[model samples]
Target: MATEPSPQRAYRAACPNCGAAVEFRSAASALAVCSYCRSTLLREGEALRRIGQSAELFEDHSPLQLGASGRWQGAAFTLVGRLQLRYAGGSWNEWHALFDTADATGAALRSGWLSEDNGGYVFSFEAPPPEALPPPEALRVGAAQVLGRETWSVASVTTAKLGAAEGELPFVPVLERAYVVAELRNAQDEVASIDYGPASEGRPPRWYVGRGLQLAALGLGGLREDSTRELKGRSVECPSCGAALAVQLATTQSIACHQCHAVVDVSKGVGADLQHYAQDTPGAEGRGGGEPLLPLGRSGALALGAGGTRSWQVVGYVERCTLPEPGDDEQSFWREYLLYNQKAGFAFLVDAEDGWSWVRPLTGAPQLGGSTARWQGDSYRELYRYTGQITYVLGEFYWRLERGQRTVNTDYQGPGGKRLNREQTGEGGDAEVTWSAGAALDADVLLKAFKLDAGQHAALQRDVKPLSSRGIGGLAGLFLFLLFVVIVFSLVRCGRDDCAELRSLYGEASNEYQQCARNTGGARGYGGSYGGFSTGGGGHK
Candidate 1:
């Protein structure tokens, strides 16, 4: 125990202080200033040290992968790519680091310009903001350079379980192949974007372009299809006896039903072609810059450009729903007229306190959902004001979405768009609660609740539900139970034949439920794929 151990063998360029063996993660890996000698060894061959510059190639896929995630505020984003850089003054170098977008905690993913080369392949890269640009290591691409290779072709991988943000995002180890591009540039000032290949193999590539991709990429949901995929939702109708529909505030007075070929009155909803007007705020290129913010609750009356009209608490139009730089590209951020649509089912979250950000086809949500205002998703619970009838119902306190790893409860922004509390639903999987109050449910939230998949857009005529007849059914169940007990009692006290008949009747009733579960249509994806804008869209977005 008292004997001193032999020193470890060092590389050819051994240090004078500690002759210990050393190893680096990547050949071109950036060097950490040596603590023992304060020296930056030039990494050559197996010799670890400082690195030189060369063009780095974007692999077909990123080395970094995403983990489990929920919505952040009103948007949904996942951790997909990461790159880190160290910038001292105006110059910088990259590091072998982690770009954790899993929870969208640090720097955001900005618009990455994309272009295809003559070689039939397209490439993309996100340009970091102009903050003396930190080396790649800061974002966690890892500080390392190709010892000889200038480029890398990122290949296959081993996945760690995904729900880490709720816990610890387990790092997936990667084996990489590198290559050096002949030329490269800090194309931030140039075009920036990325492509999401076809949502369905039957459609064209889906490109989510904007300054912030998190929102631009969350395609719509609830469309179901089969092998011979044909699009639906072009027309809507009344659920009862197929009929053409119309809504009170729609620009279009009528919508026909394709299925039942009937006429349904839509004097209830808004259509895509409806001309929406907002205070003329500036748009791209210094449009609304320096414009005074439309003070909250200061909006005037709105003309729907249709026969029906409604007044709104005009909060000014938002300037940049655009995802921050390193986010999205062309035609993203825009000014929108935020208002409550009785026909459509979304809450009119008048004005976001910060930059302009627009999510498509604005839909309503309960201040929360199926419960108290607290029961709604993060975006619904704290953002909008209640309009319409208030009905008290008992539900739970949980949101359908949230941003951040489910495990590590970090600082998440609040309803006012400020970082506030943690997203932990105290109910573990059982946070069932009971509430009583009048609350307006967003049309969109109701759609999700009632399983009304499609049809009925023009007539924003809210569907109604009558009380269940299950109460009468419950009394019948009690009568049957009492009879069965009496029969069994009499059988044991009297004859064998009586006991046999009771057993036979019980077996026949259990098989009915097993038959109904086979044809139910439902969501197949944790988030399903879209048909892209090409195939008339799966109506996803």
Candidate 2:
């Protein structure tokens, strides 16, 4: 078995290929990449052996680096190594962080992987082997499976190749070799992953469980200062229209041109692999219908958490339509604007006919019970369910999106004008669920935040009023006021003597003619006799 090594003092070895001095910080590390020649070297007692060459690390917008120190959960750790992995869509960094804790034997030190995923970071530690492991073929994305005591839903299953490595690592990693990885999330937003080794290696897959964390929570220092500036200022001309387009982030895969409205694929870098839809002509499919409510490159401050706010820029915009069932002719649609920030990842500003909601993706799946779903201790009632199809897209996105892409959406209503949305793509076990929670915002507030003119877009002029407590209170007050007016009118009419006399006379008329004669006789020219009427009160013939 591979075991940890005891702490060694002042360990240094000279590279055999380039004769460059290589330093080892952890005694357990068996391999190190040469800083000067980029050669992979293995340590054998007192000598260093050259194994292979390391690939060059790509320039990313990440602010983390080796030698940076930070604290996590009251424990301090230092970033000592990194493994850059590339996938079909993009690449990510798995930073090897060495903790202050020691192993069981106290001979070797412990380490973990801090992976950068989708503009967020996840810290994971190796967990104990499960009782029984499932084969790769048996696992599917979005399927609920039991691991240990927690029921987890698979979020993604992807294959990644080792692009590059630096500093030290606990195990030897093959360069350019592809491996399988499965990521799962539970109801509490906690994340777990399984890293399956290359099939040829015959090594058992490893499991890890951890939580998602923000960059600010790490309290890291000595990060690369120019990372943000480089990413923000990066620009390239569109291959289709030749218009200069600015790339939003280093990880952006697709960017749509503002002039020609063509979706450009930037996975191979800017101005490469551009594609456009056949129906991308002017005024087709509501493409050129109206201006966007929130224009691209506009920024606004949003309150994300307690005592903290983040400024996010509107990077991408997409309009999607929800068609009624197969035979129905009615169609409904909404618009979604993608918001991005370096530290906050991505958020969405959703505009529908009902109202506007600021949405952010949830880290975990909410627990569903019958017609209700619970998230963060709050229950949401089912609002509506429908299918959404992509109509148009503009600006940059982290994922590859195309027109006519469809998704099944379920919306739920929560307390305080909040909304919970569940969107699923694909079917059966291969489906993917994306959950988002949002609160309704006024149209004026949204426009003011983005500094947009209300009259520019007709959509912005129409505000969808939500059912709020204050509005309900106003309705209740109006109902009570009308009731009070009816009661006052009845009392005033009763106080008048004329109304009493009329009511008495009407009561008597309701009886037979005898009662009428008794009540109104002698008052008029008629006498009290019912058969014949006397001319006067006496016998005045």
Query: Largest TM-score belongs to which candidate?
Result: 2
Stretches of candidate 1 off by over 4 Å are 1-29, 32-60, 63-510, 513-541
Per-residue lDDT value at 327 in model 2:
79
Whole-model lDDT for model 1 versus the true structure?
0.22
lDDT of 2 at 198: 93
Per-residue lDDT value at 122 in model 2:
79
Tens-place lDDT digits, model 1, residues 435-520 = 11112223453233224445633222222121234544767766756753453332111001222343355542333321211111
Local accuracy by lDDT, each model: 0.22, 0.66
lDDT of 2 by residue, 68-95 (tens): 8788887777787888887665677889
Candidate 2, residue 154: how far the Cα is off, in Å:
1.3
TM-score for each model: 0.18, 0.78
